[model samples]
Target: MITTPEHDERMAKMTFASVYPHYLTKVEKKGRSKEELHQVIEWLTGFDDKKLQDLINEKATFETFFQQARLHPNANLITGVICGYRIEDIETPLTRQVRYLDKLVDELAKGRKMEKIIRGQ
Candidate 1:
C-alpha cells in the first residue's frame, strides 16, 4: 500500500471519533454488541472502556489514537486484506495499523467469533 502524502495526511488528521460511529453501526447491524466492539478494541489497542471513551470525547485523530495505544503483541497476527490492501504488504506504519483495526472490525461485522477475530488472544 503506497499511500500518497495527501492520503496519509488526511487519515492522520481524521478523528477516531469520526469513524467510531460507523464501526459501531457496522457491528450493531450485524447483531454484535457495543461491548464486543470495545473488546476487540481493547485487545488490539489496550484502550479500556474508560480510556476509549475519553479519546472519543477528546476527538483524537488517528495519529494521536495510535500514539496513545499500547498495541497488543498479537497485533501482527491480524492479517488479510482490508480496503483492497493486504495487511502485510502495507509499508506505511500508520496505514497498516489503521487497516489492522479495519480488518478486525470487518471480521466482526461479518459475524466472526470474538476469539477468532482477535486471533485467540
Candidate 2:
C-alpha cells in the first residue's frame, strides 16, 4: 500500500529518528526546548515519558536493541503467516516432480532436450 517514493522516504526518516535520538539531539539541541526533547523521546519509543525514563534507567542501548531486532524471527514468521501459506507445506515430492517436468519442457522448447544433451545422442 505504500505507493509513493515520498512516503517511503518519510517512513525511512521516521524509522531513523525512532532508532537514533542522539542523532536528532545533535542536529537540533541548541534551539530545542525541554518539551521538544520529551516529544522526541516519546515519538522515538512510542511510549509515554515515564516508560521512556524507565527504559533509560534500565540501561537500554539502541545498538544492542538493533542487533537483537536483526536476529528476531517475528518478521520472518509474519511474512509467511500473513501470506496465507506455510513454507513447510511447500517443497513436496509432487512439486519437485512438476518442476522437473517444467524444466524438461523448457529444454525441449529451446532445442536442448536433456537426453540428447546429457547422453550425447
TM-score of each: 0.97, 0.29
lDDT of 2: 0.34
Worst 10 residues of 2 by lDDT: 74-83
lDDT of 2 by residue, 32-119 (tens): 4444444433332244666555545655444332322222222122112112334234334222222222232333334443343222
Candidate 1 residue lDDT tens string, 1-121: 6878888888889999999999999999999999999999999999999999999999999999999999999899888988888998888889888989999999999999888988868
Cα RMSDs of all predictions?
0.8, 24.0
| Clash counts for all predictions | 0, 0
**In model 2, where do residues sit more than 4 Å from their true spots?**
1-29, 63-121
The top-ranked prediction according to lDDT is 1
